[model samples]
Target chain A: MLVARGVTVAIKGKTLLQDVDLSLSPGQVLAIVGPNGAGKSTLLKAMTGERKTTGGEIELDGRALWHWTTAALASRRAVLAQSTEVVFPFLVSEIVTLGIRRNLTAAEQYRLVQRALVAVDMSTMSDRVYGTLSGGEKQRVQLGRVLAQVWSHGCTYLMLDEPTSSLDLSHQLLILRLAREHALSGGGVLMILHDLNLASMAADEIVALKDGNRIASGAPVDVMTDDLIAALYGVRVQVRGVPDGPFLLPQTARLPG
Target chain B: MSAGGVAMPAGTGAASARRGGLMLAAGAVLLVAAIVAALAIGPIFIAPADILAILADAAHGIRPTEGIAMRDAVVVLDIRLPRTILTALVGATLAVAGAVLQGVFRNPLADPGLVGVSTGAAFAAVLWIVFGGMVGAFLPQAVLAFALPISAFLGSLISTVLLYSLATREGRTSVAMLLFAGIALGALAAAGTGLVIFVASDQQLREFTFWTLGSTGGASWFKIGIALPFFAALFVGSFWLARGLDALAIGEAEAFHLGVDTQWLKRLAIVLVAAGVGAAVAVAGVIGFVGLVVPHLLRLSAGPMHDRLLIGCALAGGALLLLSDIVARTVAVPAEVPIGVVTAIIGAPYFLYLVHRNRAALGG
Candidate 1:
C-alpha cells in the first residue's frame, strides 16, 4: 500500500499541490482526474519520490518513502512516466530488460521481459528499434518496462503519470485494463487520467482536484456527478448513467443558451 | 493483438551478445594489424618479419642476432616501437573517454578535446615544461621526471570536476549548459596557455608550441609507463559502467527507476574521463577526434550498448590513432607533422558532417 498525508508541493513559492492526502491500498485502482495545471501529476510524482514534497509524509507498506534506499523503493514500486525519451537505438527487448533486477537469473529475466511485452501486446516488436516506434507504441513499450519491474514483486505499487495521454482509444482501454488486472493481482495502481468516462469505468475510486486542492474523493459514481465535474473543469458537462458506469459529455452551446 | 498484429517474441537475448562478441573479436584483429603496420612503416622502414622478431626478442630477453642491423634495432625498438605503443595507448584512452563522456552527457558531440579537458591538461603540462628547471632544482630526480604528467592529471581532474558541477543541478545535467560551459572553459584554458607561452624562453616556447601541435614523437618507456595506470582505470571503469550507462541512455530518471544509482554513475564517469584524458594528454599532448569519431563509428555499426561500445572503442580508438599517427609521420616525411594536426584535419570535416546529420537534435 502507498499512503500520502498532508502532502504539499511548492516550487518558487507557488503551490502545486497543497495538503493532498490519499491512500492506495493493495488490490485497488485509484484514478486522479483534473484539468491542466491542477497538480495531479505533481501529486503522483511526489508520492513516487520523483518530486520532493514541501510538507508531507509518504509511506509505502508502513515504511517512510524518504528513508528507503532507492533500490529498495524501486523494488516495491514501478513508475511508468508519461514519456521516456530514448535517443539511442535500443532494441525493444533491451529496453524492457533494464527493468529486470540483477538478482534474477538470465532465463528468468528473459521470461519476465517476454511476459511483460506480451502483457502490453508488444511481444512481436521485441527485436525492433525503439526509436522507430510510433508514440503510442513507445508508451506501450514503457508500460512493458514498468510491468517487468514489478512483475515478481508482490504487493508492489504502480504509479503512472498520464499513461494514456498519447494512446488511442483502444490502446488506452488496453492500458487501463492492464492496470486493473495489476490491481486485481495484489498490486496498487495510482494513475493520472484525463478521460473521465474511462476513469469511471476503470477506477475503483476517483480523486478530483482543482487548483491544487482535492474537490472530491470517493467511489467513481459518488464523486463524478455532472455539477462536480463541471465546477472542477469550469465547463458545463452532462453525466449519463450507462449500463456499466457514468458517461460524461461536454455541453457546448451553439448560442448563449 | 487486434490490429497491431501479434507475433512471437523476436528474442534478442543471446544473439546480440554473440554478435557483440564477434564485433569485439574483429576489432581486436584490426588493432593488431594496425599495430604491426605502425611498427613496420616508419622512416627507415623495417620489415614486418623483422619487427615481429624484434618484439619477440624484447619480450623474451634475447639479444637481437644474425638478421637485424644495429641502426634498425635502435630505430625499431627504442624509437618506433615505443612510439607506436604509446600512440595506441593514448588513442584507446581518448576514445574510451569520449564514449563514456557521451554516455554521461547524453550527447553524441561530447568529447574530452572539444570540452576543454585536453586544453586543461595541456595548459598544466606547458606550465611545467616552462617552469620545470626552476622546480626541478629542489625536487628529487625521480619525482622531477613525473612532475609534468602529475600536474597534467591534476589539471584535467580539476577541470572535469568544475565543468560537471557547473552544468549539473538537482541531480540533472543540462546538456546545453555543459556545452556552453565547455566552450567557456576551453577559451579560458587556452588564454592561460597563451600566457604561459608569453613568459616562456625561446627553447621553452618552441617545446611548448610543439607539444601543443601534439605528437608521440617524444614517446619513451617512462612516458608509456606513466600512461598505463590511467588507461587501466578507464578500461575497467568502462566495463563496470556498461549496464548503468545502457540504463542512462534512456534518461536519468528512468535509469534511477530501473534501480541504478545515477549520482554514483555520474561521479564515476567524470573521474574516469578525467583520468583517461589527463594521462593521454600528458604522454602525447592532445590528439583529437580518436575520442570523438571512433566511438560514434562503432555505435553506428555495433549499436549503442556500451558494454560492446566501450570495448569497440578501445580497439577502434587504437587503430584509428595508429593510422592518424602514421599519416602524421609519413605525410610530412622528415618534417614529421604533429599527430594533433592529422587528427584535426580528419576530425573537423567529419564533425561538421555529424553536426549536419544531427541538426535537428542540436536545434540548428
Candidate 2:
C-alpha cells in the first residue's frame, strides 16, 4: 500500500499542493481527477517521492518512502512520468530493457522485455528506433518500460500521471484495463486522469482535487455526483448511476456570464 | 492481430548486438593496421618485417649488433615506438573523454575541445611554460617535472565544473546553455593564453606556438610513463561509467528512477576527462577532432550502448589519431604540419555536418 497524509508542496513561496491525503491499497485502482492547476500531478509527484512535501509524509508498504534506497524502491515500485523523451536512437526493445534493473539471466531479461512489449501492443515495432515513433506509440512504449520495471516484483505500486493523455480512445481503455488488471493481481495502481468517465469505469475509488485541496474522495458512486463535479470543475454536468459505476454527462455545460 | 503478416524477425536486439560486436572487431583491426603503418611508413622507412623483429627482439632483451639493422632498431624502438604508443594512448583518452562528455551532456556536439576543456588545459600549460622559472625555484626537481600536467589537469577540472553548473538548473541540463557557455569558456581561455603569449620571449613564443598547434614530436619514454596512469584512470572510470551513461540518455530523472546515481556519475566523468585530457595536452599539446570525430563515427556504426561504445571509441580513436599523426609527420616532410591542423581539417567539416543534421533538435 502507498499512502500520503496531509501532503503539502510549496516551491519558492508558492504552494502547489496543500493538505492532500490519499492512499492506494493492494487490489485497488485509485484515480485522481481535477482540472489543470488543481494539484493532480503535484499530488502524484509527491506520492511517487519525486517531489518533497513541504508538510506531511508519504509511506510505502508501511515504511517511510525516503527510508528505501533508490534501487530497492525501484524494484518495489515504478513511476511513469507525464512525459519522457529518449535522447538517443535507442531501439524500442532497448528502451524497455532499460527498465529492468534485476540481475536476471539473458533469457529471462529477453522474456521480460517481450512480455512488456506484448502487453503494450508494441511487440511488432520492437526493433524501430524510439525517436521515430508516433506520440501515442511512444507513450505506449514508455508504458511498457514502466510495466517491465515491476513485472515480476510482487506487491509493487504503479504510479502513472496521465497515462492516457497521448493515447487514443482504444489505447486509453487498453491502458486503464492494464492498470485494473495489475490491481486485481494484488498490486496497487495510482493514476491521475482527466476523463471523469474513464476514471468512473476503471477506478475503484475516485479523488477529486480543487486548488490544492481534496474536494472529495470515495468509491466512484459517491464521488462522481453532479453537484461535486460542478463545484470541482465549475461546469454543469449530469451524473447517471449505472450498474458498474456512475457515468458523467456534460452536455449542458455553460460558462458563467 | 496480423502478426503473421508482419514477418517480425526474432531477436532484432540480438542482431544489433551482433553488429556492435562486428564493429568493435573492425575497429580493433583498424587500430592494429594504423599502428603498423605509423611505425613502418615514417621518414626512416623501416620495413614492417624488421619492425616486428625489432619488437620481438626487444621483448626478449636483444639488441641489433651493427649496420642498418642497428640504425633501424634505433629509429623503430627509440624514435617511432614511443611516439606511436603516445599517439594511440592520447587518441583513446580524448575519444573516451568526448564520448563521456556527450553522454553527460546528452548531446552529440559535446566534445572536450568544443566544451573548453582542452582550451582551459592549454591555457594552464601556457601559464606554466611562461612562468615556471619563478615557480620552479621553490619546487623540487621531481615536482617541477609534473607541474605542467598537474596544472593542466586542474584547469580542465575547473572548467568542466563550471560548465556543468552553468548549464544545469534544478538537476536538468539545458543543451543550448551548455554549448553557449562552452563557447564563452573557450574564448576566455584563449584570451588568457593570448596574454601569456604576449609576455613570452621569441624562443618561448615559438615553443608555445608548436604546443598550441599540437604535436607528438617530443614523445619520449619518460613522457609516456607520466601519461600512462592517467590513461589507466580514464579507461577504468569509463568502464565503471558505461551503464550509468547509457541510463543517462533517457534524462536525469528517468535515470534516477532506474536507480542510477547520476550526480556521482557526472562527477566521476568530469574528473576522468580532466585527468585524461590534461595529460594528453601536457604531452602532445592541444590536438583536436580525435575526441569529437572518433566517438561520433563509432556511435553511428556501433549503436549508442556505452559499454561497447567506450571500447569502440578507444580502438577507433587510437587508430584515427595514429593515422592523423602519420599525416602530420609526412604531409610537408621536414616542415611537418601540426597534428591539430590535420585533425581540424578533417573534423571541423564533420562537426558542421552534425550541426546541420541536428538543427531541428538544436532548435528545440
Candidate 3:
C-alpha cells in the first residue's frame, strides 16, 4: 500500500500542490484526473518520492517512504516519467536492463527483462536502438523498463505520470490494460490520466484535482457524474452509461471563429 | 503493431560481455604498442628491441648492457622514457576526464578543455611560474617547487565547481546553461592568464608560453611521481563511476527513479574530472583534444557503455597522446612543435564533422 497525506509541493515559492491526500492499497488502481495545471503530475511526483513535499508525508507498505533506501524502494516500486529522453544511442535492451536491481544475477536480469518486454509487446524490438524508435514504441519500451523494475514480486507500487500521452489509441489501451493487470495481480497502481473514459474503465477509484485541491474522490461510477466533470473541467460533458461502463462525451459545440 | 521495423536479436548478455571484453583487450594491446613506439622514436632513434631491452633492464634493476652506448642509455632512461611515461599518464587521465565529463554533461561535445578546466589550470600554472620567486621568499623551497602543480589542481577544481553549480538548478542541469557557463569561465580564466603574461619577465613569458602550447619536454621521473597518484585516483574513480553515468545518460530523473544516488555521482564525477585534468595540465601543460577526440572515436566503435568507454578512453587516450607527442617532437625536428598544436590540428576536423552530424540535436 502507498499513502500520501496532506502532500504539498512548492517550487520557486509557487505552490504547485497543496494539502492533497491520497492512498492506494494492494489490487487497487487509483487514477488522478483533472484539467491541465491541476497538480496531477505534481501529486504523482510527491507520491513517488521524486519531489520533496513541502508539508505532510508519504508512506509505502506501512513505512514512511523516506525511511526506505532508494535501492530497496526501487525493488518494491517503479515510476514512469512523462518522456524517455535519451541523448545517446543506447539499445532498447540496454535501456530496459537499467531497471534491474544490482542484486539479481545475470541470468535473472536477462529473464526479467525479456518477460517485461514481452508483457509490453515490445519483445521483437529489444535489439533496436531506442533513439530510432517511434514515440509510441518508446513509450512501450519505457513501460517495459518500469515493469522490469518492480517485477521481482508481489504488491509493487507502479506510479505513472501521463504514460500514454505519446501512445496511439491501441497502445494507450494496451498500456492501461497492463497497469490494470498489475493491479489485479495484487499490485497497486497510481496513474495520472488525461483520458477520462479510459480512467473510468480502468481505475478502481478516481481522485479528481482542481487547482491543487482534491475536488472529489470515490468510486468512478459515483464521482464521474456529468455535474462533477463539468465543475472540474469547466467544460460541459454528457455521461452515458453503456454495458461495459460509463462513457463520457463532450457536449459543448465549438463556436464559429 | 510492428512499429520498430527493425531486426530484433536474441538477448544475450554473454555476447555483449564478450564483445566488450574483446574491445578492452584490443585497446590494451594498442596502448602497449604505442608505448613501445613512442619510446623508440625521436631525433636519436633507438631500435624497438633496444627500447624493450632497456625497459626490461630497468624493471630488473640491471645496469645497461656492455654494448649499449652511454648516450643511448641516457637518452632512453633520463629523457625519452620519462616523457613517454608522463605522456601516457597525462593522455590517459585527460581522456578519462573527457569521457566522464561528456557523460555527466550529457553532451558528446563536452570536453575538459572546452569546459575551462584546462584553461583554468593553465592560468594557475602561469600564476605560479610568474610569482614563484616572490612566493618563495616566504615558503620553504620544497613546497614552492611542488606548489605549481598543486595550484593548477586547485584552479581546475574551482572552475569545475563553478561550472556545475551555475548550470545545475532544482536538480536539473540545463545543457545550454552549462555550455554558456563554460565559455564564460574560459574567457575569465584567459583574461587572468593574460594579466599574468603582461607581468611576466622574458624567461617567465617563455615558460608560460610552453604551458599554453602544452608539451611533454619537461617530463622527468619527479614530475611523473607528482602526477601518478592523481592518475590512479581518476582511473579508479572513472571505472567506479561507469554504472552511475550509464544510468545518468538516460536522464537524471530516470536515473534517480532507478535508485541511483545522482547527487553523489555528480559530485564524484566533477571532482575526478578536476583532479585528473588538473594534474595533467599541471604536468604536461594544456594538452588538448586527447580527451575530446579519443572518447568520441571509441564510442563510434566500442558502443556507449561507460565501463567499456572509460577503459577504452584510458588506452586510446594514451595511445593517441603518444602518437601526437611523437608527431610534436618529429614534425619540425629539433624545433619541436607544441603538443597542443599537434592535437588541435588533428582533432579540429573531427570536431567539425561531429558538429555537422549532431546539428539537428544542437538545434542549430
| Winner by lDDT | 2
Order candidates by TM-score, high to low: 2, 1, 3
Task: Give the lowest summed-lDDT range of ten residues in model 2 chain B.
Answer: B1-10
Worst 10 residues of 1 chain B by lDDT: B1-10
Superposed by TM-score, candidate 3 places the C-alpha of residue A164 at a distance from the truth, in angstroms, of 1.6
True-vs-predicted CA distance for residue A228, candidate 2, Å: 1.9
Off by over 4 Å in 3: A152-155, A249-257, B1-19, B66-70, B132-146, B202-206, B360-363
Model 2 clash pairs? none
Q: lDDT score, residue B299, model 3?
A: 74
lDDT of each: 0.83, 0.85, 0.83
Q: Provide the lowest-lDDT 10-residue window in model 1 chain A.
A: A248-257
Candidate 3 lDDT over A1-257, as tens digits, reads 78989988888888889898999998999999999999998898887777889898899889998898766777788899998688777777777888777667666777887898888888888767789999888988888888888885332889999988988888888888898888888899999999888899989899999989999998888888878887887766678888767877765422223
At residue B85, what lDDT does model 1 achieve?
92
**Deviating ranges (above 4 Å) for candidate 1:** A152-155, A251-257, B1-15, B131-146, B165-177, B202-206
Per-residue error for A96 in candidate 1, Å, reads 1.5
User: What is candidate 3's CA lDDT for residue A70?
Assistant: 68
Query: Per-residue alpha-carbon lDDT of model 3 for B1-364, expressed as tens digits?
Result: 0113322244533334545667788889989999988888888889888877777788899998777776888888899889999999899998899999888888887778877888898888788888867867898877766787778888998998898789778656676677789889988987898888887777775665566669998899989988777788899988888888988988888888888888899899988888888889888888777888998988766767898889899998998899999998998977888999999898878778887887776576
**For residues B156-267, what per-residue lDDT tens digits would candidate 1 score against the true structure?**
8788888888887875666667778988987788789888988887787556545566888888999888778888998998889988998899888888777788889988
Q: Rank the candidates by DockQ, best first.
A: 3, 1, 2
